[model samples]
Target: MGAVIRYTTDGSDPTESSIRYTGTVSVSAATTLKAKAFKSGWTPSQTATAAYTMSISDTILFSPASGEYHSEQDVVLSCAVPDAIIRYTADGTEPVESSSPYTKPVHISETATLKAKAFKSGWSPSQTATSAYTMSISDTILFSPASGEYYSEQNVSLSCNTVGVTIRYTTDGKTEPTINSMTYTAPIAVSETTLIKAKAFRSGWNSGTVAEGNYKLRLPDCITFSPEPGTHFSNQKVVLSCSIPGTKLYYTLDKSEPDKKSIPYTEAISVSETALIRAKAFRKGWSPSPAAIGSYEMAIPQDCIRFMPAPGTYTEAPTVEVSCECGIPDVVIRYIINDSGSEDTLYSSPILLSESATVKARAFKEGWTFSNISQGTYMLKVKEPVILPGSNTSVTQQEVQISSETPGSAIYYTTDGSEPAENASLYDKPFSVSQTSIVKAKAFKIGWETSGAVSEKYTIKAAKPVFSLESGIYTGLRTVAVSCETPGAKIHYTTDGSIPSKASPCYDSETLVSLSKTTTLSAKAFKENCEPSEETEAVYRLKITTPQISSDAGGFSCETAEIRMLCEFPDAEIFYTTDGKMPTESSSVYDEPFLATGYVTVIAVAYKPGWEPSDAAVKHIAVKGDINGDCSADMSDVIAGLQILTGTDSAPIRSDYDYSEADLNGDGRVGSAEIVYLLMAISKK
Candidate 1:
């Protein structure tokens, strides 16, 4: 048996609105049940049950944990209790089962809070669950000590605008820094121009955008030149540049100082003559550096010209021509025809050489040195007739008398078939020829052409002897070679510096000429039926040793140089020049080393009476603002200057420096202003 149950639908207790217990009590609608057991009433089971309300389910849990997110996400509500309706709201309001039943997942696309709840017919309202879906956007990074120039040294710091993000950077701005780059842990030292790049990175989130910051902190660098100073070249352009890239360079060419407002250097400037170019650098934020001076020295070379027909003696008239070569387009050729006349005539055409004349030509251009002289001489046929003795004629008499009909004529004869020059022996008196011989004669007269040479045979003759080596100085031991024009003629030579005779050492083998003091050698020829040949001589002057040049180990100053020259040979002469020219025998001989007085190159050579000139020794010296004579003006010099000013112990004084090296203003004395100048020179303008 089962007990019956009764219940009331009103809100009342069991006495007011009673419900009896039955086999089972199920409520499909809103009702309150107060039950008690009856019929068997056994002292009324103490109201076997008091009240029955309703059953409720738990609230739902949303998937995808609540957090700030960057992308879109789905909002799903779930409940552990079965057969419960879950509802969600994206408008950040309270959620109910009937508001919007979450049959499917709710899409959350923007930044909003999702509120969810669960409900059933026999259950109370479930707990509300809310999830906030905030769309996270990466923030742009920030840089401190922003991109600009810094006068002095500075430190640069990097920061991320977004919280909880790290920044990475690198000194090499040319590359992009990734997460593997140097992690920025401390501030960077910006002593020079630098570029800093950084980016923000975080796990489970997109990396922040890359940011860059450039900081320039440096002194104005030195300016540069294309063709450096101390250049004496020509026909070129010069380019001015600065050590700092992209810096504006201004220059002046009119021998004036340069400033920022002067002509800006674009490309290169053409230098035609000597110019003192002064230049300076200019930038927006940097200080104007000291002027960099570049003075260009150039020399225009003269044109080269020459005679068309080489200068030589001619027997007949010929065409005289002049040719010239010059690099400049505007050029002219000036010429003249006299032997001792100015070349003032401009060359127009070729001239005919009808008589003996001298032609001198030279090329010239405006603002250029005149070219080297070009000279040539032309000679015509002689007017005199042939000599009385014809060529290859036979003379029977033992002595033949030859004469020229021309006025003031004189005859010279050679025993061998050789031409008679003006220096040949004069035949003033006729002599007897005891043996057969060959005679060659010529007639010469003042202000008249020479007669034709005549050669006659008197059955036999001998040729003259010729020396292989010319009559000049010879160093060391020399082997003299001698030969005659005729094959069988015996060659004779003398080493005692006297005229040779037929009895002198006959040419049978080699002859060696040793050097002692100045030694002269003479040689001649002799044959059976011919007169003795003319004597040939050579002077031998053997050398002892080369000359030596010496100076102070510290070398010379900018204004003066004292050098000494000495030769091992006692009689050797030393020649020197301070202009860098080679010292020839004709150059100025030095008695003692002298002051150079300016920036110059010193070259010296030594020559003995018969020995060759010694190899030239050269040295070059110059200076800038080297006040302490230490080859450079630097901070050490500044310290020295301060010591000199303060009268420190063991310090060099101002008078110790030379007038040219220490005198800042060329006032012939060293002063505090000079020390100041030296201090300014420390930076090397």
Candidate 2:
């Protein structure tokens, strides 16, 4: 029979496959064993035994393979069974099963310790295998916020233990965590009523339950008022109010709380003076609202008045009327007489006076006063009566005289019917009237009767002079003998336009005068101290006549070959010829007077410069020929003899040029032609 095998080693329970021996195994002196067995059927039924030391490997073991645990979680203890049955104690004790089979791995709520051992069937338990399994509760399934609860849309943080664990959360106050793959770091935003939940999960570990948190949604605090700021009011009717969402509002005016019956606005509030007001509002879950302040300054009513008066001279009566202006009610007026230092009350009445004075008027109210005075003197005098002119009508071509009744009094007059005064010119003499004239006059003087006036109407007959001028011929000098037909009068004349005076040159008896050319002769006649006659019509006439020729017989010079025939008329034309013959219309006309020349036979004729020649006067001019007369003799007598011989220089020779008397020869040409007579006279001698 085989030995019944029941063995244990290394403080472990023996098993069927544990190393078994049938013979007595040898036991060395060491604490180790060689093969030792107990056999019932071997070798004649001899009972042999051997002793050997058993060996064990050093190892540690655990009970469950893998599982989950919160922080501080304790678990049961166990070890690998081989050579011994094990007993364990977690509280630092030796192995013993009576310590209650490690009651389901002591549910450690926080981090805890674990220890275990193995015992053979008959050997004392080996050294206890010890271990400390910490129930490391991870930061898994981090709630949105770590500690305090918060409102919706409030920021929160979520965290996890595993590296890639997806966390989801909801704010709707539900236990279900929302499925959102977000890393648990920063706070999450939430809005409505919410249940903040978080879960941590990886691919291998079991998914976690929802970690729950609750929150309520709320709105931001606000406060508002009606009838907004900066509003104007004519009559103060103002409404004030305030409101805010999600909260009740409390208000105060002048730092007093408002009630239901309290007035929030004022109507018909009169502001006579400035005012300072303040108001405020408040609400919960928000900061306090600022106070509303206002200030106002009222305006005053405007009223003013102005007055003016005309300017005038002293001693002249000037009337001034008063005008009133009142902007508000209950305005009264009072005046002070500046001339007499007296005050007078005027209730819509004019103040009249009888002397020169300055008047000052003042407007008054219950609280105000205005003093305005006239700038000029107001004079009072008796009204003066006006005088009327005596004559109102006039006549033509006659003299009408209007005179003032008193001398040295100014007579005001006008033809246009306007106002007049003593400053106007005084009337003295009658006006010599021509056309029909209307005249008015007034006489004025101080301290005299103002109404005693005189006027009259008169007519006079027209007297005129008519005549003709008997114009005489001009001799190249300005002179005329004029005659008129007006009877019983003396004639006055003027060459220029000047007033005819007694000293003016007069036209006397028939005078031989010189004149230039055509001219107008003007003249008038008047009886002494009588009205002058009208001027006669102008006489437009031309004068044509010859001037007398004269010479100085004693002033003749021997070198002077020709004699000059001088005339008094500067404008006359003098014509001359060499032959001793009278000039006719066919003779050469002289543009200018003849100049004295040597031995020239000049037949000089005097006439107007442009008119036909007058009768010529023959002159026998010779160089110093007038020994007794001191005058020259010209070729007139010489050419006369030459004409007697030639028979053409002059048809009828004068006795002065006869060769029988002058030639001394039987031949012509005077003395030269009679040389034979002289020689014969000598020969006879």
Any runs in candidate 2 off by more than 4 Å, and if so which? Answer: 1-323, 336-348, 352-360, 368-519, 523-537, 540-584, 587-685
lDDT of 2 by residue, 391-412 (tens): 3332134455555434344565
lDDT per residue (tens digit) for residues 473-531 in model 1:
65444565677765567778887788888878887646544455456778777766655
Superposing every Cα of model 1 onto the true structure, what RMSD results?
A: 50.0
Deviation of model 2 at 630, angstroms = 58
> Worst 10-residue stretch by lDDT in candidate 2?
623-632
* Per-model CA lDDT versus the true structure: 0.66, 0.46
**Top candidate by TM-score:** 1
Q: What is the TM-score of each candidate against the true structure?
A: 0.27, 0.24
